[model samples]
Target: MKRYPTVLTIAGSDSGGGAGIQADLKTFAALGAYGTAAITALTAQNTQGVRAIHAVPAAFLREQLEAVFEDITIDAVKIGMINTVDVVEVIAGVLDRFQPPFVVFDPVMVATSGAKLILDETVGVLKTQLFPRATLITPNLDEARMLLKKPIESVDQMREAAEELIAQGCRAVLLKGGHLVAARLYDVLAVRGEATQVFESEYIASKNVHGTGCTLSSAIATYLALGHALTEAVSLAKAYVSGAIQAGKDITTGQGSGPLNHSYAPKPMQIRS
Candidate 1:
Protein backbone atom coordinates (compact mmCIF):
# COMPACT_ATOMS: atom_id res chain seq x y z
CA MET A 1 0.00 0.00 0.00
CA LYS A 2 1.19 3.53 -0.72
CA ARG A 3 0.99 6.31 1.87
CA TYR A 4 1.52 10.02 1.82
CA PRO A 5 4.62 11.32 3.56
CA THR A 6 2.87 12.38 6.73
CA VAL A 7 4.42 14.89 9.14
CA LEU A 8 2.91 16.11 12.40
CA THR A 9 3.38 19.58 13.87
CA ILE A 10 3.14 19.92 17.64
CA ALA A 11 2.99 23.62 18.30
CA GLY A 12 0.77 26.61 19.04
CA SER A 13 -1.91 28.19 16.86
CA ASP A 14 -1.34 31.58 15.37
CA SER A 15 -4.58 33.35 14.52
CA GLY A 16 -2.52 35.41 12.12
CA GLY A 17 -1.63 32.24 10.18
CA GLY A 18 2.00 33.24 9.58
CA ALA A 19 3.90 31.22 12.19
CA GLY A 20 3.51 28.46 14.74
CA ILE A 21 1.21 25.58 13.79
CA GLN A 22 -0.13 27.42 10.78
CA ALA A 23 3.32 27.97 9.33
CA ASP A 24 4.33 24.37 9.98
CA LEU A 25 1.32 23.02 8.13
CA LYS A 26 1.89 25.43 5.25
CA THR A 27 5.51 24.41 4.92
CA PHE A 28 4.64 20.76 4.96
CA ALA A 29 2.06 21.17 2.21
CA ALA A 30 4.37 23.31 0.12
CA LEU A 31 7.04 20.62 0.34
CA GLY A 32 4.68 17.78 -0.65
CA ALA A 33 3.99 16.22 2.75
CA TYR A 34 0.73 15.52 4.54
CA GLY A 35 0.52 17.75 7.62
CA THR A 36 -1.21 17.11 10.96
CA ALA A 37 -1.18 19.32 14.03
CA ALA A 38 -1.70 19.17 17.81
CA ILE A 39 -2.12 22.55 19.30
CA THR A 40 -0.32 23.28 22.58
CA ALA A 41 -1.35 26.89 22.83
CA LEU A 42 -3.39 29.45 20.94
CA THR A 43 -2.14 32.98 20.38
CA ALA A 44 -4.32 35.94 19.50
CA GLN A 45 -1.79 37.43 17.17
CA ASN A 46 -1.16 39.08 13.87
CA THR A 47 1.91 40.01 11.94
CA GLN A 48 2.19 43.01 14.24
CA GLY A 49 2.55 41.10 17.53
CA VAL A 50 1.12 38.57 19.93
CA ARG A 51 -1.73 40.03 21.97
CA ALA A 52 -2.75 37.12 24.19
CA ILE A 53 -1.96 33.44 24.66
CA HIS A 54 -4.38 30.70 25.70
CA ALA A 55 -2.72 27.42 26.64
CA VAL A 56 -4.24 24.03 25.98
CA PRO A 57 -4.25 21.68 28.97
CA ALA A 58 -1.61 18.96 29.17
CA ALA A 59 -4.18 16.18 29.26
CA PHE A 60 -5.78 17.42 26.07
CA LEU A 61 -2.38 17.59 24.43
CA ARG A 62 -1.75 13.99 25.43
CA GLU A 63 -5.03 12.96 23.88
CA GLN A 64 -4.18 14.76 20.66
CA LEU A 65 -0.84 12.99 20.44
CA GLU A 66 -2.29 9.56 21.20
CA ALA A 67 -5.11 9.97 18.73
CA VAL A 68 -2.77 10.87 15.89
CA PHE A 69 -0.03 8.34 16.61
CA GLU A 70 -2.38 5.42 17.21
CA ASP A 71 -3.83 5.71 13.72
CA ILE A 72 -1.61 7.63 11.32
CA THR A 73 1.99 6.60 10.87
CA ILE A 74 3.75 9.89 11.39
CA ASP A 75 6.94 10.13 9.34
CA ALA A 76 8.32 13.24 11.03
CA VAL A 77 7.36 15.80 13.66
CA LYS A 78 8.09 19.52 13.75
CA ILE A 79 7.91 20.97 17.27
CA GLY A 80 7.45 24.64 17.99
CA MET A 81 6.16 26.90 20.81
CA ILE A 82 5.78 24.91 24.00
CA ASN A 83 4.43 27.52 26.41
CA THR A 84 4.69 25.66 29.73
CA VAL A 85 6.58 22.98 31.62
CA ASP A 86 3.59 20.63 31.58
CA VAL A 87 3.32 20.92 27.80
CA VAL A 88 6.97 20.03 27.50
CA GLU A 89 6.55 16.96 29.68
CA VAL A 90 3.52 15.83 27.71
CA ILE A 91 5.27 16.14 24.34
CA ALA A 92 8.45 14.50 25.62
CA GLY A 93 6.48 11.58 27.00
CA VAL A 94 4.49 11.17 23.81
CA LEU A 95 7.66 11.19 21.71
CA ASP A 96 9.16 8.53 23.95
CA ARG A 97 6.15 6.28 23.45
CA PHE A 98 5.74 6.76 19.69
CA GLN A 99 9.39 7.21 18.69
CA PRO A 100 8.76 9.07 15.47
CA PRO A 101 11.49 8.74 12.85
CA PHE A 102 12.36 12.44 12.73
CA VAL A 103 11.77 15.24 15.22
CA VAL A 104 12.71 18.78 14.24
CA PHE A 105 12.63 21.01 17.31
CA ASP A 106 12.43 24.70 16.54
CA PRO A 107 13.03 26.39 19.88
CA VAL A 108 10.64 29.25 19.47
CA MET A 109 11.36 31.77 22.23
CA VAL A 110 10.87 35.16 20.69
CA ALA A 111 8.58 36.47 18.02
CA THR A 112 9.89 38.37 15.03
CA SER A 113 7.90 41.33 16.34
CA GLY A 114 10.12 41.35 19.47
CA ALA A 115 7.59 39.71 21.75
CA LYS A 116 8.66 36.98 24.18
CA LEU A 117 6.85 33.73 23.38
CA ILE A 118 7.96 31.06 25.87
CA LEU A 119 8.08 31.40 29.62
CA ASP A 120 11.47 31.72 31.31
CA GLU A 121 10.74 28.70 33.53
CA THR A 122 9.74 26.55 30.56
CA VAL A 123 13.15 27.03 28.93
CA GLY A 124 15.00 24.69 31.30
CA VAL A 125 12.33 22.02 30.98
CA LEU A 126 12.54 22.17 27.17
CA LYS A 127 16.32 21.73 27.27
CA THR A 128 16.19 18.79 29.65
CA GLN A 129 13.19 16.94 28.21
CA LEU A 130 13.00 17.70 24.49
CA PHE A 131 16.58 18.38 23.43
CA PRO A 132 17.73 14.77 23.56
CA ARG A 133 14.71 13.58 21.61
CA ALA A 134 15.04 16.08 18.78
CA THR A 135 16.70 14.92 15.56
CA LEU A 136 17.61 18.53 14.91
CA ILE A 137 17.33 21.63 17.10
CA THR A 138 16.91 24.75 14.98
CA PRO A 139 17.55 27.94 16.91
CA ASN A 140 18.11 31.44 15.65
CA LEU A 141 20.73 33.71 17.22
CA ASP A 142 18.42 35.13 19.89
CA GLU A 143 17.01 31.73 20.83
CA ALA A 144 20.55 30.26 20.88
CA ARG A 145 21.72 33.11 23.10
CA MET A 146 18.91 32.36 25.55
CA LEU A 147 19.72 28.64 25.59
CA LEU A 148 23.52 29.12 25.91
CA LYS A 149 23.42 32.31 28.03
CA LYS A 150 26.11 33.87 25.84
CA PRO A 151 26.56 36.24 22.95
CA ILE A 152 26.48 34.81 19.42
CA GLU A 153 27.40 37.81 17.31
CA SER A 154 29.30 36.29 14.41
CA VAL A 155 29.46 33.23 12.14
CA ASP A 156 32.29 31.77 14.26
CA GLN A 157 30.09 31.90 17.33
CA MET A 158 27.23 30.34 15.38
CA ARG A 159 29.43 27.35 14.45
CA GLU A 160 30.68 27.01 18.04
CA ALA A 161 27.17 27.30 19.41
CA ALA A 162 26.00 24.41 17.23
CA GLU A 163 28.63 22.16 18.82
CA GLU A 164 27.91 23.44 22.33
CA LEU A 165 24.21 22.77 21.86
CA ILE A 166 24.99 19.20 20.76
CA ALA A 167 26.57 18.67 24.19
CA GLN A 168 23.10 19.23 25.64
CA GLY A 169 22.00 15.85 24.16
CA CYS A 170 20.51 16.61 20.76
CA ARG A 171 21.68 14.51 17.78
CA ALA A 172 22.26 17.66 15.70
CA VAL A 173 22.03 21.42 15.77
CA LEU A 174 21.30 23.95 13.03
CA LEU A 175 22.24 27.28 14.60
CA LYS A 176 20.56 29.86 12.39
CA GLY A 177 22.52 33.05 11.72
CA GLY A 178 19.64 35.06 10.25
CA HIS A 179 19.65 37.38 13.24
CA LEU A 180 23.25 38.35 12.68
CA VAL A 181 23.98 41.66 10.98
CA ALA A 182 25.75 40.60 7.79
CA ALA A 183 25.49 40.63 4.04
CA ARG A 184 25.09 36.87 3.89
CA LEU A 185 23.17 34.75 6.40
CA TYR A 186 24.64 31.45 7.58
CA ASP A 187 23.04 28.47 9.32
CA VAL A 188 25.53 26.09 10.97
CA LEU A 189 24.77 22.39 11.15
CA ALA A 190 26.66 20.13 13.59
CA VAL A 191 25.77 16.48 13.92
CA ARG A 192 27.05 14.03 16.49
CA GLY A 193 30.32 12.40 15.33
CA GLU A 194 30.45 14.51 12.15
CA ALA A 195 32.13 17.72 11.04
CA THR A 196 30.08 20.91 11.21
CA GLN A 197 28.67 22.24 7.91
CA VAL A 198 27.50 25.75 7.06
CA PHE A 199 24.56 26.81 4.83
CA GLU A 200 24.74 30.30 3.44
CA SER A 201 22.17 32.47 1.65
CA GLU A 202 22.08 36.09 0.65
CA TYR A 203 20.29 38.24 3.22
CA ILE A 204 16.93 39.03 1.74
CA ALA A 205 16.04 42.56 2.82
CA SER A 206 12.35 42.35 3.56
CA LYS A 207 9.82 42.57 6.37
CA ASN A 208 8.08 39.35 5.33
CA VAL A 209 10.21 37.29 7.69
CA HIS A 210 7.73 36.53 10.44
CA GLY A 211 7.62 32.74 10.20
CA THR A 212 11.07 31.95 8.83
CA GLY A 213 12.08 29.65 11.69
CA CYS A 214 8.86 27.65 11.71
CA THR A 215 8.86 27.45 7.91
CA LEU A 216 12.45 26.24 7.77
CA SER A 217 12.05 23.57 10.46
CA SER A 218 8.78 22.29 9.03
CA ALA A 219 10.30 22.20 5.55
CA ILE A 220 13.17 20.14 6.93
CA ALA A 221 10.75 17.74 8.57
CA THR A 222 8.76 17.43 5.35
CA TYR A 223 11.92 16.74 3.36
CA LEU A 224 12.94 14.15 5.92
CA ALA A 225 9.52 12.57 5.61
CA LEU A 226 10.02 12.52 1.84
CA GLY A 227 13.15 10.33 2.32
CA HIS A 228 15.98 12.87 2.29
CA ALA A 229 18.97 12.32 4.59
CA LEU A 230 19.53 14.78 7.41
CA THR A 231 22.22 16.88 5.68
CA GLU A 232 20.39 16.86 2.38
CA ALA A 233 17.15 17.69 4.16
CA VAL A 234 18.68 20.76 5.77
CA SER A 235 20.20 21.90 2.47
CA LEU A 236 16.94 21.53 0.57
CA ALA A 237 14.94 23.20 3.33
CA LYS A 238 17.30 26.18 3.27
CA ALA A 239 16.82 26.58 -0.45
CA TYR A 240 13.06 26.38 -0.09
CA VAL A 241 13.03 29.03 2.62
CA SER A 242 15.32 31.31 0.61
CA GLY A 243 13.04 31.00 -2.36
CA ALA A 244 9.95 31.62 -0.25
CA ILE A 245 11.51 34.72 1.26
CA GLN A 246 12.66 36.03 -2.08
CA ALA A 247 9.33 35.37 -3.73
CA GLY A 248 7.34 36.99 -0.92
CA LYS A 249 9.65 39.98 -0.47
CA ASP A 250 7.39 42.50 -2.17
CA ILE A 251 4.08 41.12 -1.01
CA THR A 252 2.34 42.72 1.98
CA THR A 253 0.21 40.67 4.34
CA GLY A 254 -0.26 42.96 7.30
CA GLN A 255 0.63 46.20 8.98
CA GLY A 256 3.91 44.75 10.23
CA SER A 257 6.13 41.82 9.17
CA GLY A 258 4.51 39.52 6.60
CA PRO A 259 4.69 35.78 6.01
CA LEU A 260 6.65 33.82 3.39
CA ASN A 261 4.68 33.02 0.24
CA HIS A 262 4.43 29.33 1.10
CA SER A 263 2.39 28.46 -2.00
CA TYR A 264 4.81 30.17 -4.36
CA ALA A 265 5.97 26.81 -5.71
CA PRO A 266 3.88 24.14 -4.06
CA LYS A 267 4.50 20.52 -4.96
CA PRO A 268 1.96 17.75 -5.26
CA MET A 269 1.72 15.53 -2.18
CA GLN A 270 4.47 12.92 -2.07
CA ILE A 271 3.86 9.25 -1.41
CA ARG A 272 5.86 6.23 -0.20
CA SER A 273 5.28 2.54 -0.14
Candidate 2:
Protein backbone atom coordinates (compact mmCIF):
# COMPACT_ATOMS: atom_id res chain seq x y z
CA MET A 1 0.00 0.00 0.00
CA LYS A 2 1.06 3.58 -0.60
CA ARG A 3 1.14 6.41 1.93
CA TYR A 4 -1.22 9.39 1.91
CA PRO A 5 0.12 12.68 0.63
CA THR A 6 1.41 14.55 3.67
CA VAL A 7 0.51 18.23 4.05
CA LEU A 8 1.74 20.59 6.78
CA THR A 9 0.13 23.72 8.19
CA ILE A 10 2.09 26.47 9.94
CA ALA A 11 -0.62 28.58 11.51
CA GLY A 12 -2.43 29.32 14.74
CA SER A 13 -4.66 26.97 16.72
CA ASP A 14 -8.37 27.68 16.77
CA SER A 15 -9.94 26.21 19.89
CA GLY A 16 -13.23 26.43 18.01
CA GLY A 17 -12.18 23.71 15.56
CA GLY A 18 -13.46 25.86 12.69
CA ALA A 19 -10.46 27.88 11.58
CA GLY A 20 -6.67 28.17 11.52
CA ILE A 21 -4.86 24.89 12.17
CA GLN A 22 -8.09 23.09 12.95
CA ALA A 23 -9.68 24.06 9.66
CA ASP A 24 -6.47 23.36 7.77
CA LEU A 25 -6.30 19.85 9.15
CA LYS A 26 -9.96 19.25 8.42
CA THR A 27 -9.49 20.41 4.84
CA PHE A 28 -6.47 18.21 4.46
CA ALA A 29 -8.25 15.22 5.92
CA ALA A 30 -11.33 15.73 3.78
CA LEU A 31 -9.17 16.02 0.67
CA GLY A 32 -7.46 12.74 1.51
CA ALA A 33 -4.15 14.07 2.79
CA TYR A 34 -2.14 13.39 5.89
CA GLY A 35 -2.19 16.56 7.99
CA THR A 36 0.50 17.92 10.33
CA ALA A 37 0.83 21.28 12.03
CA ALA A 38 3.40 23.73 13.41
CA ILE A 39 1.26 26.14 15.37
CA THR A 40 2.42 29.75 15.54
CA ALA A 41 -0.07 30.95 18.11
CA LEU A 42 -2.88 29.81 20.38
CA THR A 43 -6.13 31.74 19.98
CA ALA A 44 -8.99 31.60 22.41
CA GLN A 45 -11.61 32.05 19.76
CA ASN A 46 -14.81 30.53 18.55
CA THR A 47 -17.57 31.24 16.04
CA GLN A 48 -18.23 34.61 17.68
CA GLY A 49 -14.82 36.28 17.76
CA VAL A 50 -11.33 36.05 19.10
CA ARG A 51 -11.43 36.77 22.86
CA ALA A 52 -7.71 36.32 23.61
CA ILE A 53 -4.51 35.40 21.83
CA HIS A 54 -1.26 33.89 23.16
CA ALA A 55 1.58 33.98 20.70
CA VAL A 56 3.89 31.00 20.59
CA PRO A 57 7.53 31.81 20.99
CA ALA A 58 9.42 31.85 17.69
CA ALA A 59 11.92 29.27 18.98
CA PHE A 60 9.11 26.87 19.85
CA LEU A 61 7.48 27.39 16.47
CA ARG A 62 10.76 26.56 14.78
CA GLU A 63 11.11 23.45 16.90
CA GLN A 64 7.71 22.26 15.75
CA LEU A 65 8.61 22.80 12.07
CA GLU A 66 11.92 21.01 12.47
CA ALA A 67 10.21 18.10 14.17
CA VAL A 68 7.59 17.83 11.42
CA PHE A 69 10.13 18.02 8.60
CA GLU A 70 12.46 15.53 10.24
CA ASP A 71 9.72 13.01 10.96
CA ILE A 72 7.31 13.23 8.04
CA THR A 73 7.62 13.54 4.29
CA ILE A 74 5.52 16.63 3.75
CA ASP A 75 4.33 17.24 0.19
CA ALA A 76 2.99 20.74 0.73
CA VAL A 77 2.79 23.54 3.35
CA LYS A 78 0.02 26.07 3.99
CA ILE A 79 0.90 29.18 6.03
CA GLY A 80 -1.59 31.40 7.85
CA MET A 81 -1.66 34.11 10.52
CA ILE A 82 2.00 34.73 11.17
CA ASN A 83 1.09 37.67 13.35
CA THR A 84 4.54 38.85 14.42
CA VAL A 85 7.78 39.86 12.70
CA ASP A 86 9.86 37.45 14.79
CA VAL A 87 7.62 34.47 13.97
CA VAL A 88 7.40 35.56 10.36
CA GLU A 89 11.18 35.57 10.13
CA VAL A 90 11.34 32.18 11.78
CA ILE A 91 8.85 30.73 9.28
CA ALA A 92 10.68 32.30 6.35
CA GLY A 93 13.95 30.86 7.63
CA VAL A 94 12.54 27.36 7.99
CA LEU A 95 10.85 27.57 4.58
CA ASP A 96 14.10 28.65 2.95
CA ARG A 97 15.88 25.78 4.70
CA PHE A 98 13.49 23.05 3.57
CA GLN A 99 12.48 24.52 0.19
CA PRO A 100 9.25 22.56 0.14
CA PRO A 101 7.68 21.74 -3.22
CA PHE A 102 4.49 23.75 -2.74
CA VAL A 103 3.83 26.51 -0.17
CA VAL A 104 0.44 28.25 -0.05
CA PHE A 105 -0.03 31.39 2.05
CA ASP A 106 -3.37 32.73 3.23
CA PRO A 107 -2.83 36.24 4.52
CA VAL A 108 -5.36 36.16 7.30
CA MET A 109 -5.54 39.65 8.80
CA VAL A 110 -9.13 39.78 10.05
CA ALA A 111 -11.59 37.32 11.49
CA THR A 112 -15.11 36.76 10.15
CA SER A 113 -16.63 38.45 13.22
CA GLY A 114 -14.58 41.62 12.60
CA ALA A 115 -11.51 41.20 14.76
CA LYS A 116 -7.99 42.21 13.72
CA LEU A 117 -5.85 39.12 13.69
CA ILE A 118 -2.48 40.62 12.72
CA LEU A 119 -0.56 43.74 13.59
CA ASP A 120 -0.14 46.47 10.97
CA GLU A 121 3.66 46.31 10.99
CA THR A 122 3.52 42.55 10.69
CA VAL A 123 1.80 43.03 7.33
CA GLY A 124 4.86 44.78 6.00
CA VAL A 125 7.10 42.02 7.32
CA LEU A 126 4.89 39.35 5.71
CA LYS A 127 4.85 41.05 2.32
CA THR A 128 8.57 41.73 2.27
CA GLN A 129 9.80 38.44 3.71
CA LEU A 130 7.19 35.73 3.25
CA PHE A 131 5.35 36.54 0.02
CA PRO A 132 8.37 36.00 -2.19
CA ARG A 133 8.91 32.51 -0.84
CA ALA A 134 5.37 31.27 -1.31
CA THR A 135 4.26 29.29 -4.32
CA LEU A 136 0.81 30.88 -3.98
CA ILE A 137 -0.75 33.59 -1.83
CA THR A 138 -4.51 33.66 -1.25
CA PRO A 139 -5.86 36.91 0.15
CA ASN A 140 -9.45 37.97 0.43
CA LEU A 141 -10.43 41.43 -0.81
CA ASP A 142 -10.09 42.95 2.64
CA GLU A 143 -6.62 41.52 3.03
CA ALA A 144 -5.87 42.63 -0.53
CA ARG A 145 -6.91 46.17 0.30
CA MET A 146 -4.76 46.05 3.42
CA LEU A 147 -1.77 44.86 1.39
CA LEU A 148 -2.21 47.25 -1.54
CA LYS A 149 -3.14 50.25 0.56
CA LYS A 150 -6.15 50.74 -1.69
CA PRO A 151 -9.67 49.58 -2.27
CA ILE A 152 -10.80 46.34 -3.94
CA GLU A 153 -14.54 46.37 -4.34
CA SER A 154 -15.12 45.20 -7.88
CA VAL A 155 -14.09 42.37 -10.19
CA ASP A 156 -12.03 44.93 -12.11
CA GLN A 157 -10.36 45.94 -8.88
CA MET A 158 -9.82 42.33 -7.96
CA ARG A 159 -8.06 41.73 -11.28
CA GLU A 160 -5.95 44.81 -10.76
CA ALA A 161 -5.24 43.94 -7.12
CA ALA A 162 -4.38 40.32 -7.98
CA GLU A 163 -1.95 41.34 -10.71
CA GLU A 164 -0.37 43.95 -8.46
CA LEU A 165 0.02 41.38 -5.69
CA ILE A 166 1.86 39.10 -8.10
CA ALA A 167 4.14 41.97 -9.14
CA GLN A 168 4.85 42.69 -5.48
CA GLY A 169 6.02 39.17 -4.62
CA CYS A 170 4.28 35.76 -4.62
CA ARG A 171 4.83 33.46 -7.58
CA ALA A 172 1.05 33.47 -7.99
CA VAL A 173 -1.93 35.19 -6.40
CA LEU A 174 -5.47 34.06 -5.72
CA LEU A 175 -7.35 37.17 -4.61
CA LYS A 176 -10.57 35.98 -3.09
CA GLY A 177 -13.52 38.21 -4.04
CA GLY A 178 -15.86 37.12 -1.28
CA HIS A 179 -16.10 40.62 0.10
CA LEU A 180 -17.90 41.91 -2.96
CA VAL A 181 -21.67 42.06 -2.57
CA ALA A 182 -23.12 40.04 -5.37
CA ALA A 183 -25.05 36.91 -6.27
CA ARG A 184 -22.26 35.57 -8.49
CA LEU A 185 -18.80 35.21 -6.96
CA TYR A 186 -15.54 35.61 -8.81
CA ASP A 187 -12.25 34.46 -7.35
CA VAL A 188 -9.35 35.86 -9.36
CA LEU A 189 -6.28 33.73 -9.94
CA ALA A 190 -3.16 35.38 -11.38
CA VAL A 191 -0.08 33.24 -11.86
CA ARG A 192 3.24 34.36 -13.25
CA GLY A 193 3.28 34.39 -17.07
CA GLU A 194 -0.22 32.97 -17.37
CA ALA A 195 -3.55 34.50 -18.24
CA THR A 196 -5.62 35.23 -15.15
CA GLN A 197 -8.55 32.86 -14.60
CA VAL A 198 -11.62 33.77 -12.60
CA PHE A 199 -13.34 30.89 -10.88
CA GLU A 200 -16.99 31.79 -10.53
CA SER A 201 -19.73 30.09 -8.57
CA GLU A 202 -23.12 31.01 -7.24
CA TYR A 203 -22.51 32.43 -3.81
CA ILE A 204 -24.04 30.26 -1.14
CA ALA A 205 -25.71 32.38 1.51
CA SER A 206 -24.48 31.04 4.82
CA LYS A 207 -23.80 32.71 8.13
CA ASN A 208 -21.59 29.77 9.09
CA VAL A 209 -18.71 30.93 6.90
CA HIS A 210 -16.03 31.07 9.52
CA GLY A 211 -13.01 29.25 8.09
CA THR A 212 -13.17 29.67 4.30
CA GLY A 213 -9.80 31.35 3.86
CA CYS A 214 -7.97 28.77 5.92
CA THR A 215 -9.98 25.99 4.27
CA LEU A 216 -9.33 27.19 0.70
CA SER A 217 -5.61 27.73 1.11
CA SER A 218 -5.23 24.35 2.78
CA ALA A 219 -7.38 22.76 0.10
CA ILE A 220 -5.14 24.16 -2.62
CA ALA A 221 -2.07 22.83 -0.85
CA THR A 222 -3.71 19.39 -0.63
CA TYR A 223 -4.49 19.38 -4.36
CA LEU A 224 -0.91 20.39 -5.06
CA ALA A 225 0.20 17.48 -2.89
CA LEU A 226 -2.02 15.30 -5.05
CA GLY A 227 0.06 16.34 -8.10
CA HIS A 228 -2.25 18.98 -9.64
CA ALA A 229 -0.81 22.04 -11.35
CA LEU A 230 -1.13 25.35 -9.54
CA THR A 231 -4.10 26.69 -11.49
CA GLU A 232 -5.80 23.31 -11.67
CA ALA A 233 -5.19 22.80 -7.99
CA VAL A 234 -6.88 26.12 -7.32
CA SER A 235 -9.81 25.18 -9.52
CA LEU A 236 -10.22 21.88 -7.69
CA ALA A 237 -9.77 23.60 -4.36
CA LYS A 238 -12.46 26.15 -5.18
CA ALA A 239 -14.87 23.38 -6.03
CA TYR A 240 -14.15 21.67 -2.73
CA VAL A 241 -14.67 24.88 -0.76
CA SER A 242 -17.92 25.64 -2.60
CA GLY A 243 -19.28 22.22 -1.76
CA ALA A 244 -18.25 22.63 1.86
CA ILE A 245 -19.94 26.01 2.18
CA GLN A 246 -23.16 24.76 0.63
CA ALA A 247 -23.19 21.57 2.68
CA GLY A 248 -22.63 23.43 5.93
CA LYS A 249 -25.08 26.27 5.33
CA ASP A 250 -28.04 24.45 6.89
CA ILE A 251 -26.03 23.02 9.81
CA THR A 252 -25.59 24.72 13.14
CA THR A 253 -22.59 24.62 15.41
CA GLY A 254 -22.70 27.81 17.51
CA GLN A 255 -24.41 31.14 18.01
CA GLY A 256 -21.83 32.94 15.89
CA SER A 257 -21.11 32.24 12.22
CA GLY A 258 -20.36 28.51 12.13
CA PRO A 259 -18.01 26.32 10.11
CA LEU A 260 -18.24 24.49 6.77
CA ASN A 261 -19.10 20.83 6.41
CA HIS A 262 -15.56 19.69 5.68
CA SER A 263 -16.15 16.06 6.49
CA TYR A 264 -19.75 15.79 5.29
CA ALA A 265 -18.54 13.86 2.25
CA PRO A 266 -14.83 13.24 2.34
CA LYS A 267 -12.82 11.99 -0.60
CA PRO A 268 -11.05 8.67 -0.26
CA MET A 269 -7.50 8.76 1.06
CA GLN A 270 -5.22 9.80 -1.82
CA ILE A 271 -2.21 7.58 -2.42
CA ARG A 272 1.01 8.11 -4.39
CA SER A 273 3.41 5.58 -5.78
Best by lDDT: 1
- What is candidate 1's lDDT per residue for 113-169, written digit by digit as tens? 888989899999998999999999999999999999999998888888899999888
lDDT per model, in order? 0.93, 0.92
Tens digits of lDDT, candidate 2, 1-273: 568899999999999999999999999989899999999999999888999989999999999999999877899999998889999999999989988999999999998888898987899999999999999999998899889999888998899999998888778999998889999999999998899888898889999899999999999999999999998899999989899999999998988999999997898888887
Model 1 CA deviation exceeding 4 Å by range:
none
Cα-based RMSD of the predictions, in order?
0.8, 1.0
Look at candidate 2 and tell me the lDDT of residue 161. Answer: 90
The best candidate in terms of TM-score = 1
* Candidate 2 residue-wise lDDT at 227: 96
* Candidate 1 displacement at residue 104 in angstroms: 0.4
**TM-score for predicted model 1 compared with the true structure:** 0.98
